[model samples]
Target: MSRNTFRQASLALSIATGLAALSLGAQAQVQEHSQAQRASAFSKAQGHIESFRGRSLSDADHSFEARDLVVDEDGAEHARFDRRYKGLKVLGGDLIVHSGRQGALQSLRQTLNRQLQIDTSPKLRAAEANRIALQQHGGELLSKQPELMIYARGDLPALAWDVRSFQTKADGTPSEMHIIVDAQNGRVLEAWDDIHTAAANGTGKTLYSGNVLLTTNSVSGGYELRDPSRGNTYTINMANRTSGGSILKDSDNSWGNNATSDSTSAATDAQFGTAVTWDYYKNVHGRMGIANDGKGAYNRVHYSRNYNNAYWSDSCFCMTYGDGDGTSLRPLVSLDVAGHEMTHGVTSRTANLTYSGESGGLNEATSDIFGTMVEFYAANANDSGDYLIGEKIMIGRSFMRSMIKPSADGASADCWYAGVGNLDVHYSSGVANHLFFILAEGTNSPLGASPTCVAGNTRVATGNASLSGIGRTAAAKIWYRALTTKMTSATNYAGARAATLAAAAELTATLGSDYSAQVAAAWSAVGVN
Candidate 1:
């Protein structure tokens, strides 16, 4: 999804033979490509592949198989292809070729090393690898089968075993982590968490937002609190359980009381927030649903006894909100909170930004940005739109994070610095949050009683005069395009800068003024340059 332009070059075919073969398994079906498709693919991909590797792609030495052909709304086509060498899957060898409207090559993204040489034969047995993975994860084994595959880590490709096992942390949190063990020397290469949970610490006062419309269904017993318009989204009461929450049944569609004593009141807010978030994306960004697949996600309220946080899980395709300790915070079903959590689902489906490092920072900021946008779109009288995050939850605290001045939260940085990516994702998100505020409301400008660009947060001056906003509409559109079309898993602050600039260029193609310049100026204002 980056804007790295690829140059066309003539490619020559060369032959290389005698290599270990791969156990195709279920992926064998995708390896077959028709002659017509192969020719068309090669014609469009040759230039991109050569440009990315800075060498000619030999058909005899490598095999290219088309996996997915997608044409976006802008008429920009993206073709994903898998690479093979000597009948063996090139491990992480995958490339995405982007073509312009006229079918001309635009750019390419490759995950494999151009020159790969490694022994594919495993020395350690699969049983030993599984035992090692079990010891590392937890001592419990969930599945007995282990998959033997080539594990590629940046330029180093090695024969490895991918082992999966169940684990419970010291805090009693259930999880599953994939441990990649080197088959050659039996060394652990890497490990990653596969479990997705909305980790808030513990739900109900009254309905936070006032009376709002909800789409419900007429069931056999009574009207069910389900949204028919927005992917049939529904809310259930967990009754303080970790799983298997019961569906709430109401005699009438009207739910919630103005006060916390009623359990249904909290659900009123969760359901309303989901509906508003859905409308915001559809009405403003032309997105169909969370996954852009026209399907709704369910919500589980009252999750766990005294749980204090809310989260969106892609694994469950649902959102879970916790009832806060009544003395500290209210239910986590506030409008902005719902928007923030659901945005995680959107990020998961789109860029799938890695949940650590600089990309993780961007991932969190994306949620905050859209969450704020959803609030603005809602514009409810009781809970008006503002840049303040978690405003309703922290009761007396007023707000959690401020988009106008991210460092106001004490831990967040207002500007970027060297090694800034090493900070926590929540704190590192300040850089992007600051840039977005400047883009939407301008520095030194006042937005709805809240003055823009307060001096409390540390920021590098642009030397240029205060900015004039491109408006939230333009800002959101540019960001969405950058995220969905120009970002990769490893994209960092620099990559984000490039991606946003490219997005602005595409958006303001026919504009007289330079929109990309404003994008760069905003980034520089936050010390990104």
Candidate 2:
């Protein structure tokens, strides 16, 4: 059990024991104290409860002080607060304070502090407040221990805290702890322990710290290898999600209690590319990092032994990429590849389009579009704004999925016309990618229209089906709007058509676009409209 858990359980047990003792025989319990001691605490506790039976606001502010009140039957003076509540009268302790809105809470806290005796109000030491929470509801605390609670003063959120699910490194260990703190008053509110574990341990959830085996060499900054000469390994340095900014240091990259080796060149490439991708999203879209919720996750490069794929796991809340057959070819850490995988996170948070059928295809297309945009956004001359997918990371004889011509990657369908969903997401995304290219460059000569692959997924007659190129600027705006607003749980090509229209209309409402028609034609070119 964690320290907080033990603490909360302790408080609850104590409260129960106290209540049971009080009910057993009031006179015997306070036999050493005065009659005043026998009367007030229990009576006051009862009053506090009754007052909370959903009263109104106008009648809520209740304050009082009982003189020489028998705190323990010796007539010891303990402060008293009576809430003749309008809404909830029996409100006390942490939850009551945190649950209140910001403005009213300030008033309420002051009211509580003034009404209750300052000495008896549970003034926790700053160190104790570090992770202890004390909660009293209906005049009874929850844990057996009165001193320490599950809610130590932190984790209180602004009125906008969203309830989230968290998993932990397998071992049946809890991943997240619930502690409610008053944002306004900075007081402990209420908290609960999240009980979950890692997958590898069966009882616990495995936290895969994407650190792959690495070999140290004087040259190439030491690359990642499965069985390098010196048994070296490097871990994917995780980007801190809860905290803001970046921590670039030796301690940050230390993997598995071992010294850092920079992992594979691909890992370094992927990490750097993702960092760039993160910066691009923030710069262009004004997004709050990755999830647009002011949160960004880390990328684990060199994921398994010779693993040849990349995927995002919602359960882990992170992305994992495999090295190319444990060789130099398929590096997921490539620039476009990094952008591609990172975009999956954005799609998950926004559209949440499922990974099957047409929605899957659209989802893949969304990734490709954003991935390409990130590449261009960075203006990295080494990796220009091209329709090609994985130019640097060679898979087989060619790069991973080719957007210019899906068939070039030995998979994807170059243009959308129907039956796009029948293929893989990477290939199926061609239609949308083509449309994006059109939106950016218009019909005559598309921007970065490298070489076209066999348009076999839907139609093979490929001769530069020039969309009334609305330009990538317009395409990006339409995509952002559609993903954020118009899309839902199962977004597909048809959905994309409608969403883009709606997005265009919204844009038209604001920007007054002759550009919307251009967007429509681009969508129509690929069969969305």
**What digit string (tens of lDDT, one per residue) describes model 1 on residues 246-348?**
6676765556677777788888788778877887876666565687655678888887766677777666788888788776667788888889888888877
Which regions of candidate 2 fall more than 4 Å away from where they truly are? 1-265, 326-328, 395-398, 446-457, 461-468, 509-512
Instruction: Write candidate 2's Cα lDDT for 1-529 as tens digits.
Output: 0111110011111110121112113323333444544254435433443354332122234333221121211222222232332122222211111111111211111111212211122344433333333222111123322322222112221211112223332222224433443333445454333221111110000111122222211212322211111111122533312223221222122223211233434444544455556656655564544554333465565544454555555545555655545354454555566677677777766555555456667777787788888777756544566766666556345555555555555555656655666665555666677666667765556444533223344543256554555557667877876676556534567767877876686566444575667777666655555
TM-score of each candidate structure, all chains considered together: 0.77, 0.50
Locate the minimum summed-lDDT window of 10 residues in model 2.
Answer: 197-206
Clashes of 2: 54
Cα lDDT for residue 101, candidate 2: 19
RMSD score of candidate 2 (Å): 22.7
Of the candidates shown, which would achieve the greatest TM-score relative to the real structure?
1
Q: Each model's C-alpha lDDT?
A: 0.68, 0.45
For residue 71, give model 2's deviation from the true position in Å.
Answer: 54
